[model samples]
Structures are given as C-alpha cells and as structure tokens.
Target: MNLLEKGDDKDIEALSGLGIVSDDKSTITKSTIVEVELDLELEETLKKFGLRLESDGCLNWQMDASAHPRNWSVSRRAFNTSVLLALDLYTTAISTSGPSMAQAAMKEMDLGHIKSLIAFSSMYQFGQALGGVVFPPYSECFGRKAVYIATTLIYCLACVLTAEVPTMTGVCVGRFICGIMSAVPSVVVEGSIEDLFNMKSRVWIIFLWACATTAGLVLGPIYGAYISAYCGWKWVLFTGAIVTGVFTLLLLFIRESRPSRLLAQQAARLQHEKGLSYPIHSADATPNLATFSRIALIRPLRLFFTEPIVFVCSLMMAVSWALIYLFAESLPSVYASLGFTGPSTSLAFIPLLLGIPLSILFRIHDQRVLGRRECANLALNPEQKLTGFVIAAPALAVGLWIFAWTVPPAVPHLHWAVSMIGLVLVGFATNEFACTLSGYLADSYTIYASSAFAALAFLRAILAGVFPLFAPRMYSAMGQNLASTVLAAVATCFCGAALLFMKYGKTVRQKSKFAGHSLVVNRATQVKGDNVE
Candidate 1:
C-alpha cells in the first residue's frame, strides 16, 4: 500500500510502538524504514513488504501516517528559544539609550549648544515615532526576522555615519536614522516571545526582558560617558555601530517564527511534494499584498481609537518612559553641578543597578509563588498580575521627588545616588509591569497585538523624544526639586490608573477587540500559529 493510505486502530497502535502519534489527519506518503541485523533473506523480504532499510541498522518501515506537526507547543525548549529571541529583539532599546548619552557628547563638544541638543533630541523623537508607525506594519507583512535584519542594518550604517561625521548636523541626522531603525528590536520583542511562550512562562520571560532593558539604560549612559570623556564624542556612535554590526552578523541563527508565514512555507513544500496542481489557497496561503498593506497601515489606528485599555496603559508606560529620558538628560548636568567629575558622571546612573536585580527577583517570585497559587487554585482570576504596577507607580513618584530635591550645587554627590536608587526602583517596577501587561494584551487581543503596540509605540516615542527638549529648560526653570516633583505627580496619577486596572482590568480587556481575543487561557483552547492582526 502507498504510505499515504489510511490505517486501522491496530495498525496505528502497532505504529505507536515505533514512536508515532496519530491524529485526525493521519497519513504517510513515504515508506517507513526499519533496520536491524536480520538475515539477508529477511532484509530482502522486508524490502519486498515495502519497508525501507535504515542507516543505523535498526528495522525501519514506513507506514502511511500523517500526524499534526508540532508548531505550537509551549515546551521547555520552545520557551528557552523564545526568551533568547526576546533578549535579542529588545537590544533596540540600546539605540534609544544611545542618543540620550549622545547629548552628553554634544556638551563636551560645546557646552552652550543647548539648541543643538534640543534639535537632536527632537529629530530622534520624530524618527522613533515614524519607526513605531512603520515597524508594526513591516513585522505584520514580512515577519519579525526580516524587519530585524533590515532595521539593524540601517541602524548600523547610521551609527557609522554618526561616528564619522564631523559636523553637528551629520551627527543629528545619524542619530535620527538610528532611532528609526532601532525600533524593530523593541516592537519585535513581545511578538517573538508570544510566538513561543504561553502565559505562565511568558511572565518570567517578560521579567527577564524588562531587567535586560534596564541594563541597557544603565550601560548606555556609562558607555557614552567613557567614550565622550576619553575618546571624544564621535566614538559614541562608532562604538555603538561596531556593536550593532557584530549583532547583525549574529542574526544568522534567528528563524522565521510567525505562524502564518511558516505555514505558507510548509504549504509550498507540501505542494511540491504532492506533485499535484496545487492545494486551494487557505487563509495561511493568501498572498494579498494589498490586504496586508491595508491591515498594516490601518489596524494600529483602529486599535488606538477603539481600545481605551490600550490608551491608558500606553499612556502610563509612556509617562514612565518620558520620565526616564528626562532624568537621563538631567543627570550629567545635575551631577556636574554637584561637584562630580566627568568620568564619574556616568556613574551617577549607578542607582539603576539596584532596579535590575529587583526586577529579576520580582519575576522569580511571581512565577514561583503567584503562578503556582493560581495553578493550585489559590486565586480565582489572573488579574493578580496587575498588582506589580501598584507597587511601581508610587516608587516612581517618590524616587523622582527624592532625586529632584537632592541634586544641586548644594546637595552632596552621595545624595544624588541615593535619590537615583529610588528612581531606578520605580523604573524596575514600571518597566516590568509594562512588559507583563503587554503579554496580557497579546493574549487578550488576537488580531491586533502588533497594532495595539504600534499605537502605544507612537505615544511612547513622541513623549520620549519631546521630553528631553524640555529637560534643560525644566531643570533650568523649576530647579531639580520642582521639575522632579512635577514628574512625580504625573507618575502618581498613573498609579491611580494602575489601581483601577487591578480592580476592573478584566472588564476593560473584555471591551477590547485585540486584548480580549489574543489571550490563551487554556491548552485545549490555545490557538497555534495565529497571526496577530
């Protein structure tokens, strides 16, 4: 019989002994192979019976069988792969950090050129916003790997240009290009991890990503400091360019993980093997370029209008981000006025170190204790995840207030570090919680995850870009204490929103087209290889 022939239960059961699982679509199109040191005559007999010989000498036979391909399981190996990709995907945050430090370089080149810094910061923000708009569509159309490669390549070139350029305009242009291209890493992180991880494992991985992001924040400034102090400001761009080039070469290992795209590949391979005209195009096989373009362009706009959950959450996340950038800009000047040395200026960001470890611990605690509590029937709802933010918002406000009040020609350098500790503590909380919420949104909104994020990314890039322009003036006008107090108040308002989410998030999610549908609550109900619209 042809290997594709249907078999009965006994035949399937017997084949199961050989390590195959059966499902509704079971069929095999090739001969089964079995090999062993049977007599030559027996081997010949088995061959005549349509069994193929094996290289290892074990008896191998082909039975007509087709089992469901394992493209959707959230196993240990899959989770590990997802985490690694997520880590790689978020390295774009480094690009964002790079420009903030680039400002410090501008100061070294000329202290009075505040207008130049403002122009650079504004361009960076617009580039970031443009990237946010474009990357979502690209990720949806071409899949994550393509966008990753394309953007990283552009970013690398931009870095090289920035490093080599002699004029302020050249550096500004390079910074803008880098900002736009670097967006892929941030946008791709959630989608890539979700492609492999389910809810329980996703939480831990999200935590890992959050901590990793903070590390970028910590390292980027210090990197800029040393480069500007010792090698001149141009090296800041050169060094980042070199690092991105190395990473770009490392992209060889990443594979296409999008379900729809992979399915299309599989379907193409199957058509070639079937030796037939072609299978009717399924949803997975539809190559409507116009449709993809429309979805890519319009979906995020729709999500922004339709989803209040997305709006509030994104705003909160953006506010936190703006504060981080604002503070980052404030630091060199803040510490300089406090009698700190140029080499030691970057070290002022050392307060961020405490936040990184705390995020990891929080992630571990949630996975071990909280996830288990639900798994063991300790909680009725998964909304307990929102609690992490409740802790973060206040810390943000408190830290900003502390850092603001303590900085100056008056306050000691140690006091700045102390306040920074509080600032980073809040950062750890907001950053971690934001990641968790992102996963939650992905689960809740099946078709619009990328779009929803795109909307939020637009908001985030705008705030992050615009806030720094005001950084000098804000600190200049209100002084450190009051400027920070204003930021702290903004964070405090968002804290109340987080509390609201803790109480009624499910209701909010239920209202979302994207968030409600994307969540995978049970293994049986899991949708595999789904394209987040």
Candidate 2:
C-alpha cells in the first residue's frame, strides 16, 4: 500500500478533521502555520467544559491562547529554541569526545580490549538508532514539550552515571542510555522549530542549529583534550550533566505544540473534570502508544527502501556524516605530522568553523529567493526548497576531492593553509547541503517529517559511529590520500544521485499520495487567493 493509505496518514489529516486540507485564508502566506477553524459542533462541545480549539487545532482552555507554543512571542520562541539547540549541541560533543578519552579511560579502568573502547562510543550510536525509532512516535502522541523535558532529565541522569563510575562498562552503559534519552532533542527539536517559527523566519534558526552541531563535533576534541590534561575525563561528563541540567529546567516552560496530542490532553481533562467524553475523538481515534511505536520503528526502514527522495537524501547525509568522523580521525594525524600537538591541535578545526558564518550567509540569500517567489504568487513545492542542496552537492564533491589531494601521503605534507582551505570548503558546502535537505524533507513529508528524519538519522548516525572505529586502520592501509579519494569518489556519485532527485523530485513526490495531494491543494488555494484579489 502507498504510505498515504497507512492509518497514520489518514489520522494525520484528522488533526483538522479533513484530508490534506489547507486553512481558509485568502492572504498570500509564506508560513505553514495554519489557523484551522474548528467545526462548530467540536467548538461548542469544548465550550461545555470551557475548552476551545486554538488556531492550530490544539485544545486550549477558553481564552488561554498562550497555551499554544506557536502563539508564543518571538522572544519566547527564541529562548525555547536556544535551550533545545544547546541540548542538541551537547549530544554531538558527548559522542565525538569519546575517542579522545579512550586511551586515558582504558589505562585508568584496566580495560584490555580496544573494542571495548570503541564500544564506549559506538554503543551510543547504536542506542541512538533504537531510540530514534522508538522515541519519536511517543513524542508524536505525547507532544514535543513533554518529551524534551522528560528525556532531558533522563539524559542528565545518564551523564551522572557515566561521570561517577569511570569504568569502561559503567561509562559504556551510561553512554548508551545517554544516547537514548538525548534523542528527545535530536529528533524533536525540528518539530519545535516548526512550532515556533514560520517558514521564512525559520531559515536562520535552522542554520544556527546546524552550526551548533558542527561546532560541537569540531570543538569536542579540544575541550575533551583539555579536561583530560587538567581536570580529567570525568569532568567532561560532569560538565555535560551541568549543561543539560540547565536546559532541562528551561524545557519546562515550553508548551505542547502537537495539535493531536494537545486535543487529546484537553479531551482527557474535560472527561476528568466534568465526566464528559469527546465525540470528535471517536471518528479520529487518538493514536495509542503501542500502535505509534510499531509504526515509528518499522516505517523508517520501509521509507528508506521505498521512498526515492528519502533514500537518496539518506545517502547524502550518511556519507557527509561519515566524512566528518573520518576527518576527525585523520586530521589529528595530519596536524601531528605538522608538529602541532596538545590543544593547538584544536586549531586544525578552525576550517570547520568556516561552515558557521557561511551557512548564515547562504541562508539569508535563500530566504530572499523564497520571499521573492512567494511574493510573485507562485505555487511553491518542496522542490523549490531544495535549491541549496542542488548547489551544495557538487560543491561538497569538489571540497572532498580538494581534501583528498591536499592532505598527507599525496604531497608529503602540503602547506597547512592548503589543507585548511579544503576543510573549510567541505565544511561550508556541507552546511549549505544540510539547510536545503532538511527544509525540503520537512516541507515534503509534513506529517511524516519526524519519522522520515528518523530514517535518515539511522543511516547517518550509524555510519558516523562505525566509520571512526575503522578510520585509523583504513587510513593506515589505503593511506589517507587514497582513502580520502575513494570517499570523494563515493561522495561525487551520491551528489549525482541527489541531483537526479532534484530534477525529478516533483514527479517522485507526485506519486506520493500525501505530498502530491499537498501540491494540488496548495495550487488550488493559491489560485483561489489570486482570484479573490
């Protein structure tokens, strides 16, 4: 069956109690923020218990518009995103920092096996794989705010275990648990972005979120090396605990944004207070935890194998992430060959910092393009959102090949400036690719965005986890230049794959009942709006 036939897809439409219905507004709008009208019967039923549907179809106590996260002020939204983004940053730092501590932890804990050391890190990714599948459906049923706050607390506790125990086994278990709990921010923050910002406004926020992820990975070694030198590796976990603890406190202020869950909560509250049950829920049953989990875990794999866009983009991200870990493993030796050691090794990552400001610039320009398109009253598709990826894909290939030829074994240690330039190019292009890929997926998938992300994350996260474990040996045997060249070749091929999707993406999405219906609906609405004007 097509994905639209899946019960989830139909129930997704039941949010506003119509299949793929656009909100009834004649204004030319740029954002997906819908001000859905509640059916009068549904509205009056809620009023009997002093509840009403907000503009997004979420139930709110009568006159309590502030209960909806979308209704939050810009400052409030910014604050909430900052807290979630910070938590996401911490996940990357904790994951990548593991290798830096491996030698020290093995020595102190008397662990004889090198595989155990790899386990300390890779197990986190494995756990994240499981969590990525399991947690998103619950968040879908429960709401993002509750999941973020709840999982963050659990994640903090896991950090405490890892910090206090200091044994390989203890740390590995804690790391795995930390990985599972951290999926809250990893998986749900995108939804939070949707809740908080409209389409145009979200561009920079997402750009910064990507910057923070890359910054965490690039900066992890520097900070981990510092703690290992002076304060000890345990302090690394201690610091993460402290940081996440603060963010968890902030997550408490975030309100529920899932319209379905918000309505369910309202229904339950009314039933408890006045002994009344809602009929709206009978036609569109609230997703129970069990059914949601089954779909969440199984659907991603199906989507990965079946959906062309999701599959291709999944490869794009998987290779991109693997290169990151590979770079993390290889760059240290490149700098060591240049006679830079200690924290100065961190300076090698300055090129990766190039991704940050460059991402912001591209985002600004892309938003301008999107704004112009919307103002012209053009019908927008997710294909339009993918313009950045189309540009970045080949650029990323070029950047990778640049790294292939510039670094060691290819030219007996070229100028540090040359290799750094290669790294900078890769970093910037990767960021641009990220901006488009994510926005396109979110726009195309809509109700299925988180699940689709979970699918993409599985490939990328697992690749990142496993690649570092073999990087040292791979670089040793094939040599850095040849190995990097091979990776570059693979990336170049994947870049082509992405372009194929870009050229034919509309046709692929048109075959998808959900996305295709969305396109028709949007075009009809826009045409109606133009006629009204």
Candidate 3:
C-alpha cells in the first residue's frame, strides 16, 4: 500500500517531519502527498539557490528559448539595436547644439560675456557628469527599458523647456535636465547591446556605437548652425524635442534586456501559477539599496581613484573627448577669421565626419588580425586590444601639431582645406582610440565593465564641459598655434600610456583583484585539450 493509504501514528509523525501537519487522524487527503512533493521540490530549489542558481524548476529559459533577447531573430535584434543607436546619437547631439547657436542665444538673453554663453553647453555637460554616476545603479536595479522610457520622456520635456522658456535661468535649467536624461543612453546602450548580441558580434556593434557618438558631435554643430540660421535658435531645441518625443514612443516597444530582471520576472510568474511559497531566485538576484549605493555611488569613484589602468586610460580619453568641445567653441571664430560666414563655417567639420568611417575600416582590419591569432591557437589577452590605440595615439598628437601649424598666422596664405587634413587625422585617431580603449576596459574588467565605463564617462563629461569654457580665452591669449601646440604636447605624453599598458597589461591583470578570469580560463582550457590529445 502507498504511504498515504497506510496513514497511522507513525505515518503522521513522518508527515510532520516533512513540515506537513494535520490534527485529525482520519482526515489525511491525496492533496497532502502533492504538498509533500512540492515541499521536496522547493527544498531542491533552495539548494540550487544556495549554489547561485540560474534556473529553478520551470522558471528558467531552456535551450532555444524564444523569450531571451539573444535568441530573438536577427531582424528583430537589428531593429532594436538600430533604435538604441538612434537614441544615443540624438541625445549626444544635444550636448553640442548650444554652442552653434550661442550667439543667437546670447543676443536674446542680453548676455555680456562669452563665458555666460559657454554655460549653455557647459551646464548641460556638467549635468551629464553627475547623471553618469547616478543612473547606472538604477538601470542595474530596475531594468534598461524602464530607464530609457522615463528618461527619454523627461528629455523631451526638458528640450521643450529649453526652447520655450524665455529666461536665461530657465534655459540653463532645461539644458541641465536634458543632460541628466541623455546620460542614461550614453552608458546604458552598452548593456543593452550586451543583452542583444554575443561577444563575437559585439565588436561591430560597439564600433557602430563609437561611430554614433562621434557622429553626434560632428553633426550637432552642422545642424544647429543651419537650424539657428533659418528657423531661429529656439527651433534648434524644438527640433531636438520633436525627434526625442518620437523616440520615447519607440522605447515602449523594447523588451527588458537585463537577464537577471528577466529571470526574476519569469520566477514571479511561475510562483503565481504553481503556488510555491519558497523563493526561486538566488539571494543576490535583485539589487538592494546597499548594492545600489555601492555600485552607483562608491564603486566608480573607488575604481577611478585606486585602479591605475582605469585612471590613465580614462584620463587620456577624457582629454581627447574634451578637444571636441574645445573645437566647437573655437572653430567658428577660427573659420570666421578666414572669411567663412554663417552656416558655411560649420562645413569645416565635414572632414572630421569623413574620418569616423575610415576608423571603422582600421577597426575591421584589427579584428581580422586578432581572429587569425585565435585561429592559430594563441590565447587572446586584453593587451591585444591596444593595437588600434597604439596606431591612433601618435596620430592624435601629430594631427594636433599639423592643425596648429597649418592655420592662419602660422601660415598666413594656406588654404583652409589644408588645415582640415589635421582635423581628419584627429577625428580618425579619436574615434579609434575611444573604441579600442573601451573594448580593452571591458575585456579587463569583465563583470565590472559597467563601473569602469561609468568612471570613464564621469571624467570625460567633466573635462568636455570645462574645456569649452576656457577655449575662447586660451585661443585668444596664446594664439591658435601655441594653444594647439600645448594640446599636442599633452596628447604626445598620453601616447606612452598605451605603450606602457600594451607591454605590462598581463602583469597588471595578474595582480588585479577585479580583473577578468576568462583569459586565464581559456589558457587552461586549451592546455587541458592538448594534454588529453
């Protein structure tokens, strides 16, 4: 007879051992056995949770699961990625939009100093610096889609405020709010890309992301110039709002891409359906307040201060990024001195735009070289990502010097297009440097890549904002040649950072507590295979 059929005092004692209790001796039912089975299943789930479970009973994605973002059809993934790229591009463009229309804004507001004018862009960038540190933890805790929707909606409203509000105070406040909202896309797009694509596919997608960022910087001045020239300066902001509003609507369709969040959601549904009381997710499944504080508030600053690799690389990239803003402030005056007027002055940035695509070609070549090394059974390391940076670093320094020497007063009668060659080189080097350094950080940090990037973003935004404030004054006092020379000298010094890391990167990683273990594991796995053979 079954255990339930043989229910007696001993059987009741056994049921009590399983945490099943009944007071009446003759009232034991079949449902009691089902409850015991569920109890046993829950025990197994708890055991798995203790071991850091990824799956529990029916609450996990199976092989070929249609629910996971990575398993989605290529067309669907591409569509989502495209939407994300567009969002990043437009938001970034807003950072520079004020510079091109500064004169119009200054006239309208009766601003006396160019410093006050620079505040329009600088304030926005300052907001971005803060937002970069503030938003990532929220994304980690809540999910990517929620952050995108909420931020983009506020970003649209901020744009409208900047455009419609009459006071200078109102405009600056709006710009600041816009910057905070825009920072979400800057840092979070990488996480979304991680969700949609695997490592091998990420290279091109990341290159595209780098391209989108640089393109935004280049296009911002061009579009802002023309829009302010014809439709008035207010329309420049109005245009941003209208475009962002459309993107906000598009955001509603994006699936949640954070894997942990998705798993938690799946577990919740199963818990409701099965009526299991035991928790299915692991203890660390959701981010708590402590986790949020550590990641969003403390960790990035700690990494930035303590980690040499993060500090040096981020500092170098920050300076290069700041140069873009410096150019935005200085370029109009530079071109205007050469007799270029109105929106035509913005055309000088076209060469910089051309250089971005060329950098992608170099990136593709670097990938092939790395691919061949992998095919030959060589283990890839983070240092291998430095190949592009090694090439780009010296080019950046040399480009600045070229730009300094080719401009007017240094060479009074030289063609304006000749000066643009330096900008072309600068653009290519800057883009490649950003792409390779970001990849190297990701490879080195692995799971902590987001924190590393947040550190980088924070430093880069601060410098980008500050550099433009001094650009006009620096160019005025030191003259273009000496000012550009000083920048080139700084760039030259940073070139050593790439070389130093390339040679000693493995040694550095070996000593790093937070460094990724994938390379070490790959090396061991390969050795094991050879020994087996």
lDDT of 3 by residue, 281-366 (tens): 32124457776775557767877898888888899988988888888878888888778998888888888888887777666876
Give stretches of model 2 more than 4 Å off. Answer: 1-68, 111-113, 266-287, 514-533
Summarize candidate 1's per-residue lDDT along 142-191 as a digit string, tens digits: 66777777777788898788667646677678878877876666655666
Candidate 2 residue-wise lDDT, 449-496, digit = tens: 676777877887788778877888887899878888888787777567
TM-score, cand. 2 vs. native: 0.82
List ranges where model 1 is wrong by over 4 Å.
1-112, 275-286, 368-370, 373-382, 409-417, 519-533
* Weakest lDDT window of 10 consecutive positions for candidate 2: 524-533
The TM-score between candidate 1 and the true structure equals 0.78
Overall lDDT per candidate, in order of appearance: 0.61, 0.68, 0.75
Query: Backbone clashes per model, in order?
Result: 31, 0, 0
Sort every candidate by TM-score, greatest first.
3, 2, 1
Using TM-score as the measure, name the better of candidate 2 and candidate 3. 3
Question: Whose lDDT is higher: candidate 1's or candidate 2's?
Answer: 2
Q: Flag the better candidate by TM-score, 1 or 3.
A: 3
> What is the lDDT, from 0 to 100, of the residue 290 in candidate 2?
74
Estimate the lDDT of model 3: 0.75
